[model samples]
Target: MSGVLVIAEHRQGELREATLEALGAALELAPQTGRQVVTAVLADDPQALAGPLMGRTHGLRLMAHPDLTAFNPEMYLPVLEDAIAAAEPGLILMPHSSQGMDLAPALAGRLGLPLVTDCIGLTYQDGALTAQRQVYGGKVSETLVLKPASMYVCTLQGGAFEAPETSAVDTAGEEITLTELSPAHARRFVEYVAGALEDVDIAAADILVSVGRGIGGPENVPLAEELADALGATVSCSRPVADVGWLPKSRQVGTSGKTVRPKVYLALGISGAFQHQAGMKNSGTIIAVNKDPRAPIFAVAHYGLVADLFEVLPKLKDKLAG
Candidate 1:
């Protein structure tokens, strides 16, 4: 194996942030394993995606095809196979997004390579691959050791690794041409349907004030929102809050919801279930308030207050106002 191959993901003619996060993981592992890093970007117009990715990888492979306007397993698999053959990578990684989820398992099965999904941490030692992932709803972690193969495939979790800086390395990635390609066809590219308009993008927020069932009921959601307004933070909620129609599903955070890495995550009246923790545990600072001292949220919080959020939130809001 000459290097690690990172499959760059794009949609609607633009690169995804998760691709950068996957690249960052590849770069981190390259030095330790003494292997180079290569990135493959497949697009209808591969040139348009090169600007942001230049000088970052040991090599760049661009596969262009008209049918690649959007990601489909049938169209991408052939080009990906060619890229892997050319790169001869020991490991292949992509972000665990919708596309990755759709493509990785089939690709690994076709190539007879072991596969891991939603891996948060990775180690390549003596050519053996070990992956770390949260299990039992993030209450416990499990490590997987795969049987040896020529190459390994994995879809990594987003928000687990930092995206690489634009000017981190000087090795300008030279683009490789994919020619005379005949792709397989089973699924066709379809129009992307945008979800309901979200009022707040909690994933991009600098700070988040989130509530849960402990907030009492839908009426008290405004209290959390008021605190968020005072702190200039966005209001988010646990799955239960959204399930009960207290908040929109877009504002919910958990395994089934958006992953966020805010600068500060203030969990108010939230018991901090493992599922909820999966979404915001990566926040820079975690301050949790719950009447239950044994709330699981405190395990990941930098600061914990074992008091009634109703009383504390009002006083804290006043403190901030003053």
Candidate 2:
């Protein structure tokens, strides 16, 4: 039971993508750290939650309770405490999302364990685990090594690691556990309200035609729209474009905006700064269009076009439309 334990995050009857990414990060560090990877899925019927993680992790610990249907910190804390006692995990990994942000700190404080959040990468060396995070608005990266603590808790940043694929044959048997919990006193469970329906959520868009400062001005934003329409893709932009009010903040993609993992990300006029890349680097197919051949964006682009976006935009639109 002295292995790594990952607290799986799920919502709306489905596991979040961040959970799989956290699993990937944990599996990557397991070999060097000499810890087996175990996942903890807590729900009213934990068995129902085991499908996605089957064969993707080294082990599974399922905690089931009727009160655990929704995410309530009060109910979750007791279950986690019991799991920790039973599993004796060397390290605990959680998603750096709403749920993990709320649960990790409190759990760490209560357990008197070291905790690191929003870690973009994890490395194990010299018998120590190091976590990497962005600093100064993603201008620089800082590494942290927590020592003297027998165990540590970390929250992995979303979209930082690739999602692991699931298999059918190599599923690890799950261990069923239970925890007793009183009703939530601080906050009671209420109905879940969905966010307002927007014209498009760039994060959910499969294909994104994103513009940058190179779009020149708001008047030229329509050019990106024309191309996006031709490609049946949503139009998103970088921070600078949103700063200048050429587009809504919701359309911005970067550290300061929403992260996107579109299948085809068309970066027009983007310089490929780390801030912007942090949002779309995981996109399945990245095609960067910029006049500067030396732009940093080309480094991550699967396809790079070293030409003026203005000239290429129209031709590309026509070709796609054809």
Candidate 3:
């Protein structure tokens, strides 16, 4: 039986939730393939990723390299490519992060393998794995099946799979051997530059209040900020608002921008376009305030308010303040 390989994603000694999600998908794929799931962590420090896989059911491997200290395509891709060759797994799963987007395609090109990017769901059908992916900015979903290959590469969408619980026995004294790769050509990381709008990571925020074109103009953003302040939430905006320079691109929420899964997402004066919804649909509780009752944002929203945000926001803010 061919094994399934899950790539662990981490940065600065912290494992990404998407890695666990990928593991969940790997677990499901393993039984169908009748093989054990194997997880591989590619990093400078393999020990840092031990916590997430401590209680995992499948086999784990660590691929460590000095060049992998920071994400660089030239260095990390070759190491991962070598790992895949060594493991000889049937399927390779990775998170659909910026790093994954860069590496998955390059790896696929290097190995001449079929690659499926941004998969939201996976299922086994007739001895083949079918992956579901969003098309046209989440307006439609397409299922893809790869031709028979030694190995397949796929990037799993974030929040598509829930993290599984780790058992005490799973974390006990189990350690996988670490493999080192010596690449003829390596990319070196020199310096890191932070984005000017670094505070715009809505995914890390507990509360997010996002605005759309319905807010009318840039001047009206203060009103939205007021409501956000009252609710103790960070302010975000849709693509249009950000494109028009009303807000920075970092604050944009859509398929072209950031995908955030905040605890509470408040959509103010925003018409929920499919692109925008894709970013925040995974949020815990979505509350949309739009004057148009026909706005598509209400479809996925847990709570909907059909009224002008200008009027609704002030009342809600005052009530909260009181």
Candidate 4:
């Protein structure tokens, strides 16, 4: 069997946490399928790769090229497609970020392979690889299996896998080989538009307190902010909050907003809409406070409180303060 390949995602020389998570998922699949796990990095500077990936995986391969300096789909697609052809990997794992969403399907189309997007879980049974993915806005989980094709590409949802710990491998001695290829298409990145809060990223926060429509109106956002302050966590909002301008789009969390895997996620007055929960279902410990017990958030929450946020939040904050 061919080995499993994990595509390393980096920007400006920094490795994204999702890459390690994908590596961990790939490692889990490797033992079951009896295939070696290899990580392929596409970057200009090969020396900037970090984390315990070197010692943990079976091998590491780097594809360095000047064209990869900026993320260009036309340029990246051909390079990744060529790498896939050369490696003939049984499974190709990628982070389900914006870039992955754009490139995975195109690559699959080019290679004539089946592609799965936003996979939350992966397992093997009866010698077949199965993936658990959310459908209908996360209202349902569908299991999918791949055929005999050697190439299977999937984008993993953020926070789906636990971050792997670094091993004692001599990364300094590891040598990376580069592949040079010319892009068939030409497109240039004009400029990058920065978000309002450049330094504040909700995805990287450890604790998040998010608000939803159940909070009433934009006037009630202060209550959520107060709760966030009490917990020493960042404040985010559901899609409705952003759509109504109660919160900035930068602080939105859901399928349309930023996907987060915080250590502790407190959903106050959020009814657990599928679009909203898709972004936060991977939180380490989820606590949802809603008056509607039938709210879908409870399905994935570790702790649920069926009560009015107006009454419960202030008291909870007071108790925490005392």
Candidate 5:
């Protein structure tokens, strides 16, 4: 294996945090699997996006073209194929985001390499890579092993890896730019259709009181609201709460919804499924209140109270109010 190649992702000219997180994963694996880390930044002008990543990788390949303003399959596909052929990296890591979802599978299929998506854990042992991902509503975990080949491609789950800390100190890393842009394409880029603005932006909330199926009924949701009001926190929910129409989809948190990193996340009557945990697991302090002590939410919580939330809510709310 030559090295690890990280395909960086960006949006609207700004580098996405997922890029740094992918780099972090690549950096960790480089020692175990590769001798170097090469990050390929595909953009119109990679200068701005490549700045923070200067000392972060063994090499930065700035793949540039005018049509690269927005993500286009036709524009990105050929260039990435060429880069892979040139780099011959043992491992290829990218974000499991919208762009990555589109790119990774197609990249692997075209090149006949092993591929995995939305991986939460990755390990290299005995010259093979093992990927861990969620299954069956996050209740079951699936471990997939990829046998060694020329290389392997993987898309990482959001919030799974911490973004790497960066500095301006010089390293032995090299910077290289490529201008071999795909000239002709049948499809052209179009304007983005944005979703309607939500009344509340839960992603920006520092404190979130999130509910789930265990909340029982929609009528009982006010208990959570009251607690949120008393604590000056925002109300969020797991997927079931939103699916049952108890809350708007905007307030939902999980893989199929939004990812949040609040200062405090209070899970009330929530089971703490893997999908739900993936969204808010990185909160500063996690406190779970559930009747079932074995609820999966407790596994990631910093503080837990195994009791009925119906009994806990009013008391906790009043205590905060007092």
Candidate 6:
């Protein structure tokens, strides 16, 4: 009857946002399942990576080994399997990123455990864990539950959960190091390639003014830019904008694009599709402007304005300028 185990992911000597978000998901599930939250990080410097997550978990397991510095499924599988064996967690959580996508399935297969991938929602009910997954590119939702298994593995969708705030806790994390793991020579460490060419990371932006197909055409993209300028924010868009050559692929925000956690997200003309929401749902404030009153974006949006972007943008720009 122990707690959940979150497999933390790090890159370039820093913990990724998905790691904290997975912790957030674990924190939410803990109350329902009545289990403590334990996080496991496999890295060269586990102590440095585990610093920020100190009070956040009931225990922090650092599987530090030189071979784990880089992300390779060949090296990660055995190390993670060892960590899971020691933890014996009821549930294991991994981020649904490139690393998790490669690692989770193989790890689950190796351990003969049931795994649910790209889960948007997770809850404990009837003494079983239920996960919600979006099918058909966020059009349909299916709930999955595993039975007769002592342990379960789940991959949390990016930006699906909020990052937990730092709180001072009296409890200190218990760190354990595993020395038995050795590098799997099947794959060798290679150089890391940058995903975006731009220096500005949309994922790191605090305020983002995003547009979708509702902006009518590519010409209206400048209006979103103007609004972003006035608000001292960055301009981002949905996949359609980038698809039509209106914006660069780097500015696209969705399941296939960069996941952002901006402080204020102004989504204009976006239909609030699940794919788009998957990237920005964790924003501190989501102000959605769409003519359709029934748009799904409003469900997660903190503020909603039912109106045309043509009229709303000018007024917003004028007000902000004044």
Candidate 6 clash pair list: none
TM-score of each: 0.78, 0.72, 0.77, 0.77, 0.83, 0.73
Error of 2 at 279 (Å): 5.8
**Of the pair 4 and 5, which is ahead by TM-score?**
5
lDDT of 4 by residue, 1-322 (tens): 4768888887766887788889889888877777777787777765567455666667777667776766777877776776677777888898898778877888888888779888889875554678998776455779988765556888998777876667722333234444565666767767666656643689988999998888889888898888888888999988888889888899989876888999999998887766687789899999999898877789889999999999998998999899
What local distance difference test score does each model get?
Answer: 0.84, 0.83, 0.79, 0.79, 0.84, 0.83
Give the per-residue lDDT of model 2 (tens digit) for 185-214.
567679887544556789988899999989
**Order of the predicted models by TM-score, top scorer first:** 5, 1, 4, 3, 6, 2
The candidate that achieves the highest TM-score relative to the unseen native structure = 5
lDDT of 1 by residue, 86-142 (tens): 778999999988889988998998888889998999988776889999765455779
* Model 5, runs deviating above 4 Å: 167-188, 193-195, 201-207, 229-233, 254-264, 273-275, 282-284, 291-294, 307-322
Q: Which regions of candidate 3 fall more than 4 Å away from where they truly are? A: 168-186, 195-209, 214-216, 219-234, 248-264, 269-285, 290-296, 305-322
What ordering of candidates by lDDT runs from best to worst? 5, 1, 6, 2, 4, 3
**lDDT tens digits, residues 1-322, model 6?**
3578998999999998789889889888877767778888888888899877866677777777777898888888887777778778878998998889988998889899889999989987765778898776454679887674678889998878877876622235555565766545577877986666864678888899999988888887888888888888999989888789788889999887888999999999888777688788889999999898877778889999999989999999888879
The clash count for each model shown is: 1, 0, 1, 0, 0, 0
Q: Where is model 2 more than 4 Å wrong at Cα? A: 125-127, 163-179, 183-185, 198-208, 212-234, 238-279, 282-299, 302-322
**Which is better, 2 or 4, measured by lDDT?**
2
Residue-wise lDDT of candidate 5 within 292-320, one digit each (tens)? 87788888899999999999998997788
Give the C-alpha lDDT of model 6. Answer: 0.83
Candidate 1's TM-score reads 0.78
RMSD of each: 4.2, 5.0, 4.6, 4.6, 3.4, 4.7
Better candidate by TM-score, 1 or 5: 5
